[model samples]
Target: MTTNIDIIKSSGEKVKFSLKKLSASLRKSGADEQTINEIIEKVKEELYNGISTKEIYNRAFALLKKKGGYLASKYKLKKAIYELGPTGYPFERFISAILKYSGYDTQVGEIMQGECVRHEIDVVAEKNGETTLIECKFHTEQGRNCNVKIPLYIASRFKDVKAHWDSKQHETKLEAGWVVTNTRFTKDAIQYGNCIGLYLLSWDYPKDNGLRNRIDRLGLYPITVSTLLTNREKQFLLSRDVVLCRDLIDDLFFLDHLGISETRKSKIQNEIAMLCKH
Candidate 1:
């Protein structure tokens, strides 16, 4: 029983709100149908023409938090990742960590020599004797998408690396060139990646292998998603390169470095323990 509600996106474009789309996202986060319906009904009541999607998202998230805290936090994963950086370097480290959890040996900010020029790779991951050169495209803004020209540029860099390696008699070979981003890719970017066989992992691209899917599969959420911490606290942790929830768990003393009270640190510790549980 939803109306034809149009909402404004972060990009300032207007589009009709789709309940089916909202429900699908909720379902992916493991929300029961009853809870999903309830959230939808509540969000519908607040909808209006030119309503921002962030407003809708916030309303739905608040309802979901009341219904299920974990699911609500999980829904915040992408935005939490947006909090990971004022730059892309931390995101490159974050991606390296994700790859490591998936059984790949990873290194960040590695410079690989090319025939014509030296290329610096954001991440270099190896698994089952295959190596992937990853170029991380990160966006601090929510609505920006990686475009076709990015892949075109990455493809050129991959050629230089390949050409450099081809001239050598080395044991390691290039398995793939990947452009991983915290946001989505444009239609042309996906098509270009498919046509060229270069890998692309954006927020929700490539079916079940997108960045979100991979993160969900492993439950390797970043520390930025914690409900126990404020936005300023999260940014402080990110500044120290403490991006993952597990990082705090591994070193509880890191919380003390934040100049917060012991009680707050304990709350954060408990929340991290719950959010990062297997």
Candidate 2:
């Protein structure tokens, strides 16, 4: 089995190789190959020995984003990944996975009522016939603040629930709402969520053990094997490396090939191992 460090080195090499190939192709097409090559070299020089392939791509994309025109494709791919999901599941997968793991049946990417317009709910989890609307936030460390979105989601859910109630004759209604994030929510966001009866679920790395332990205790199983595999397939298409992408694709095809359950823990271990191997 390949070690994590090896994987990282290999992936970095592949990124350099791919950039060289792309530069040469662009040169042949009469594009500004020299500038592209310089950009690639600059990015490579700045990259550390153990940087993951994704980080390298992000750096290149950021550089391209600063430039104009055709380079926009590179930036678009990065933006797509950031906005879509870590694994290309539309960011909503995080919300859906948490709900599923918590034993709630969920519908992802659905539109719900706001005050006057329809806004998309990342995930809607139903348990014992009560529905909880969820919104997912996948942001960087600086973007972890959830105060604005939290209040907006709560207000939207209130409108949606009220509309649903008005449409029906039944009196008993569903319970609360939820906002899930890949980063920790602000203290005020958490307190406000509680005040409005909206459950907040955040998932970061093990560094935030308090929150992680609490979520684990909740025993949420929102992500299914099928959903994970689907996400893997989508992400693979956006990958620049054929070999590493194929490896990930194959791994998804036979998830138990490493003899681990297809749960969040196993997936995290596999991803970490893969990144480290690079």
Candidate 3:
């Protein structure tokens, strides 16, 4: 099949599929050119008009997993982020961990007083004496983009919280508000965020400075990305606020508590070590 084959994006927009983009993504997963070409050839055989990116990804991921679970874990990082859901709290913790590793002091699930009310912020990140009230939009399913209404609501809430902070004579000042998500933001949402000076972060926003980019650059793959760990074990780790695989390296007691055998535990450690090397 040619690149002309129409494919549906997660946002429900139809676009021509590009093999080059697919190759680049596979390469980022550390797949060699021969393996990438083979996977592309297999994927091309399954191509059809109106196929969703999700299906294409599943096919590619299954093929990659068969080759090696470690590489497949990197290839399926986006879906692993989705697996942090069913509730947004795990995602909040995940985001907080990302910030913490990036040299920011972060607090998750904070209930603080706004100018006129109390607000439960998803994450409050501080660095360089500037605090940012970050609200996260976590979506479990694909294709759910954050639209203008989300930023609109966040902007107003940010204004209220910032007002409270600015009114105080404090050492750290509330500098900006951020709206982050595990998915993409609509055009209008991004435009609105820019116009109001609110920082917006999502799966692929702000070009190379997005959440995925940060996670990859910092080797902050979520523990859910571990192919060796079962869902129950992953959830157990999440309950203990262990989000990143890098963090799991330091917290092997969770595995010990779950009665993971030494053979399997060593293998899991090996996989995490490879992934965290970035």
Candidate 4:
């Protein structure tokens, strides 16, 4: 019987092969074929001899992430792997890489003291004299349920912070707190987050349009990956096929740190439609 680990490992291997094929296809699309090859080769050369195939795919995907003009292709690769089932480790790693690329000085998997006991925050990022803690959740479906544990966990940790950390005389204080989920947050959770000044992020949100803008404003990445990817499981709805196309529209509306109204949603959707046609 192949365990989930076995499947994950096999899928990683397949991703390596798929990347090579993708590189070749890029040649026909007027990509810098030689540069692409060199990049892929360097990635392969750095891999351990017995590294799981999923890891190889991750390594190559990470390389492509650094390369420009390949966002759609990257998404395709991600979707394919996700369809193979949850490769939690690789998925978490992918998110971590993206976060680091954005600029946070990140740490993963450490025990943080919560209001009750020591709880772990998946990723903790500190940069430019501010600290931001992130809790990440990966779910394959939507509407299943948002985990209540995250807010509680964050509340506990935030409560643990010394009052001096936010003193009036202090030059810097924690700027924001985030809970990043692969799926959308529930209405209650979103309201709670807003009430407490905690921000929520989801992978389904557009990078160019939504989260990227926030990250840019906040200057949040270039953080290390190990400081993220905590072991917490929650279930939520998978992205509907339509959701993929709506990414830009949804992002433009939702990215407004203020709030989005139904009228604004319609306007943004129109704008997105026009942009997509162009």
By TM-score, who's the top model here? 3
Per residue, candidate 1 scores C-alpha lDDT tens digits across 1-278 of 34577788887888889988889888876789999988888888887888898998888888877874467777788788998878888899899999999999999999999889998999999988788999999999988988899999999999899888888886678869999888888999999998998988988888888888887778788987787788888887778878788888879666787687988777777767767766
Across 160-212, the per-residue lDDT of candidate 2 in tens digits comes to 75576557654334567666665566677777777776667665423444333
Please report how far candidate 1 places residue 43 from its true position, in Å: 1.4
Off by over 4 Å in 2: 1-89, 113-115, 141-143, 169-172, 204-211, 214-234, 237-278
Provide TM-scores for the models. 0.91, 0.45, 0.96, 0.42
Worst 10 residues of 3 by lDDT: 246-255
Q: Candidate 1 clash total? A: 0
lDDT of 1 at 224: 78
lDDT of 2 at 67: 59
Reference-based lDDT, residue 155, model 1? 96
RMSD of candidate 2 to the truth, in angstroms, is 15.5
Global lDDT of model 2: 0.49
Arrange candidates by lDDT, highest first: which order? 3, 1, 2, 4
Q: Model 1 misses residue 149 by how many Å? A: 0.6
